[model samples]
Target: MWKPILLILLMIFIGVVGFHIIEGWPFLDCLYMTIITIFTVGFKEVKNLSPQGRIFTIFIILGGVGTAIFTLTKLGEILYEGGINRFLRRRKMEKKLKSLKNHYIICGHGRMGKTVRERLEEEKLPFVVVDNNEKKLLELKQTYRCLYIEGDAAQEEVLNKAGIKKAKGLAALLSSDADNLYLVLTVKLINPSLFVLSKAMDEEAERKILQVGANKVVSPYKLSGLKIAQGLIRPTLVDFMDLIIRRKELSLYMEEFTVKRDSDIVNRNLSECDIRRTTNVIVVAMKKPGEDIVFNPSPDIKVETGDTLLVLGDKEAIDHFEKSYLGGIS
Candidate 1:
């Protein structure tokens, strides 16, 4: 529309100027003649046309009519394709969100939220994102091929739509600490056992979020500062630890398991329990109820029900231990 309008205006300008120069006609007459000629109205010319005026009329008709057709075609194509593509994408996201369960909901798409999403992707965890910024949410959906909800995460309705009640965990990384606090509190109220990790801008905010029942509170600035110091002090050790934490194949996660009362290994020593012999996992530490953790416990240390074992091994070994001793796998 715009291009065609501009083209017509330019043709009129040329015609008016040409008539005034060659035929000595007034501006109004030249303008009237230009409009009638371009529309093929075939009205009488304002005055007798010189050969120069006839040539200018031919150029005007060619340029104006072609531009009008091109502009209309492009506009029609945009309306036809863009609208349908947007609708289909929205429908797909809705369907994906509806079927989600045991999935994570990331409240923000900022730095912390993006990092969390990447880590979850590395671990093959399912998740959906929520952000008030529609452009950012669309960008995330395109980049990660994940479902996203464009809304305020602190709102109860938005949380419910994200399946907060069925979610296994959530990460609150909204720009404002207060918003994260509100989200944590709301989620906790809705599902008391849903694990939540939230970001805090400062120590006070961190404490507030924890008080609101967030399972963990992370401060990116503080954590980054500590990481920088560790990198300088123990670069090699830090690198090794990062490898383990970031590795996907080994999946060597540190999981704590509490011995069950009826387990067969309830009264056996660590060596006699045969976790190392049977599952090839190391019991790095043991923490008795109400007691501090003991690291690298001696093999002779007695394993009892209610003692929490901090084990480190690949997923396969962990699975074997959970099945053989814990009675069922997590």
Candidate 2:
């Protein structure tokens, strides 16, 4: 903006001074002549001019027209590239992120974190990714439309921007163990109620991670070896579970839902709730807070708040059960 203004002012000054010196016109008359010439108004000159003045007017016109065209072009590019449209889109995204509740935050975008995000998408869960990798963010934007903010995960400001206070959970999957530990600690301090999951690089880090308030710690290397071992002995069982869980096109998948405080099913026994009869969904297990998971819970077990129900059913059935039974708390 300043460039075009200064250039045009310099051109006009040169025109005015040259005309005043060459034609010996009054200062006002020279200024008027300069303005008319630069604008190509074709008005009559203030006074009859020498040949040198006409040549100078010709130069003024050329410079003024060139500067005007350049200014307009640069202004157009600025408006198109860094103007209101980009700002509005960014504001819209920020507003949406702020309004998110019960959404998960993924603190890294490495291989493990990307896989976690894919699984979340498969389950139709909302999530946001926080990382400092511009290239990874660009690639993720192309492939996934979930909310993402680029920043240091260990920083409270970044977590607050991701709505950690309202977020249901967060996963710390940064490359380094120290960073993940710091990220987990920060999240716990910000929202102690929020469930935290962190990735562990070393076996010794798992205990430290739990002490730092991570509810669960995942180590991809450890899980891969277990899966391989399971496949060797329980091949058919593994295939069956995979067929049910991995094949989303099928009518069955495993899911979990939290029992809310005011849910209708709270304090009611499983048989009384009659989940299978009403929703045609199986309640595979239930875990009370600080209690062991009761696999294939009995009909007489009572539901309670903070209990997580592991269920297996179709997507629509799960949604219906969650809404109608969980009291729509989320």
Candidate 3:
């Protein structure tokens, strides 16, 4: 693109200089004559030409006209290439968005929204991001290799384009409380069943957002304050949590699994199933349907259908336990 533009400028400069030197015309007249000759606009000359000037005009015609055509060709190629690439990219993005189902939709690409997206990516979950900032969305697409839509997330049409109807969850992390509130409401109207997590800056906003069909509302400032207090109060406990949550140095992890009806250990107790002997994963807690979670459930407690098990151990052991006794539904 720059190459053709520079070529055009160079050609113009050469034509102006050549006309001034060869025809000895005033600067303005020479410039006008050069423009007419280069473009071949069929305009009459400003003054009669001498033999040398006529010969010089012929040279200008050959070089300047050819350069103009070359520049126009380059311009056309640039436009065609750019237009087709944009068209193809948009088509590809639309196709991918259409094929996504049970995926998460992120309503912003700000700090909290970015964190949520990173976590979902780590979990190998499918998700799409929505934001009104085109440059930011382009950066995200390039850096994270993620799908995104450039539009206001608070609008119903944008949410629909993000496939809110088919999404299992949505995170409304818009910049303002009013925006988040409106987005949550709009999302519920689009898909009442979608689990919405939103960000709020104040208690009142959090309450209002929750009332507007948001399943969860997080206040970053509140969480940060609580975390600071906890870290000072019980540093060891916080460190332990951080270790497990990050799983950077330690292979240990905590995971939850749902017990399906057809699993072999559905009717069996913990001891009867012998999950520890088989996979070395401990049952940290279990929640049966319509019941509160029971922490550190006894070995005699029987495993039942629709039970959610929260276990802690090495990732591989936990995976093996899931496959062997927990119906592999994690």
Candidate 4:
């Protein structure tokens, strides 16, 4: 913006001085003549020009032409790169939110929500975030590829825009317990089956959240205290667990996969399946369909439909099980 203005000012200053020296014209007349010449208005020159004035005119043309070309090129680049298209895309996402279904609506994108989003990303879960802060939303969009609806999470219109009716779950991590409780109640009223995980600031709020139909209520402060104590008492174990949870290279995660009727592992015993040998994953527990959980089950225990197998493994091993053992081929 300033570049074009500066270029024009420089041209006009040069033209005024040159014209005064060559034709003895006033500053105003020289300025007008310079404008007309640069704009190619074809106006008559105020007076005849000397050799110096002609050279000055050449310089003006050279500078003005380059400036004009640069300005036009920048404008073209902005349009070509879809600057306006991206704005329209965001508007479209907002419009499309009204009809979204089977989506997860996340209220608040703070620390807890960030962790939840990370886990969701690992599982490739689709979700939309709602927050009042535009700056925070911008930062989140830049860091994590996800849809966002900017508004107060407690409001019905905001929740509706987030497609709460179609949403399978609502994770309310609002800073306040009262807000989370209100959000939980609203979500439950809108969709009775919608699974809700709310944040509670205290025990009283935790109880209220449960009463309001929140599937789970987590208190960050309480959890942090426990974690700190655990770190002090069992530092080595905590460090190892943290490494598994936080390190992308290790990519270790605990996952529970349910066996479907058609799953290849439905009728296979642990020994016969040889998952440990094949996938290098540890079978931590086998949760039977209608029986107690078998922690560290023996090799002879048979896998069955509707049973969940809790395993600890790297992402690659989990991917293999999800593909080869589950229905997914890749």
- The true-versus-predicted C-alpha distance at residue 70 of model 2, in Å, is 14
A best-first ranking of the candidates according to their lDDT comes to: 3, 2, 1, 4
Report the candidate with higher lDDT, 1 versus 2.
Answer: 2
Q: How close is candidate 2 to the true structure, as a TM-score?
A: 0.73
- Give the range of the ten consecutive residues with the poorest summed lDDT in model 2: 136-145
Which sections of candidate 4 miss by over 4 Å? 1-3, 6-10, 13-32, 40-47, 71-86, 91-103, 118-124, 141-145, 165-168, 258-281, 286-294, 297-308, 323-326
lDDT of 2 by residue, 69-138 (tens): 7776877877865676657766877998989998999999988888888889887888999999998788
lDDT of 2 at 236: 87
Model 1 scores worst on lDDT over the 10 consecutive residues at 63-72
Better of 1 and 2 by TM-score: 2
Specify the highest-lDDT model's number. Answer: 3
lDDT of 4 by residue, 1-330 (tens): 456567666766777777777768888988887777776677887777787777877777777666656766766766755576677777777777766777788898887777787777776777888989777687765543777878899888888888888888889998788889898998888788887988888899899899978987888889889989999999989888787766565668877787888888878899998898888888999888568889999999998888989989987888787777877742
Candidate 4 residue 197 C-alpha distance from true site, Å? 1.8
What's the TM-score of each model vs. the native? 0.68, 0.73, 0.75, 0.75
TM-score of predicted model 1?
Answer: 0.68
Clashing pairs in 1: none
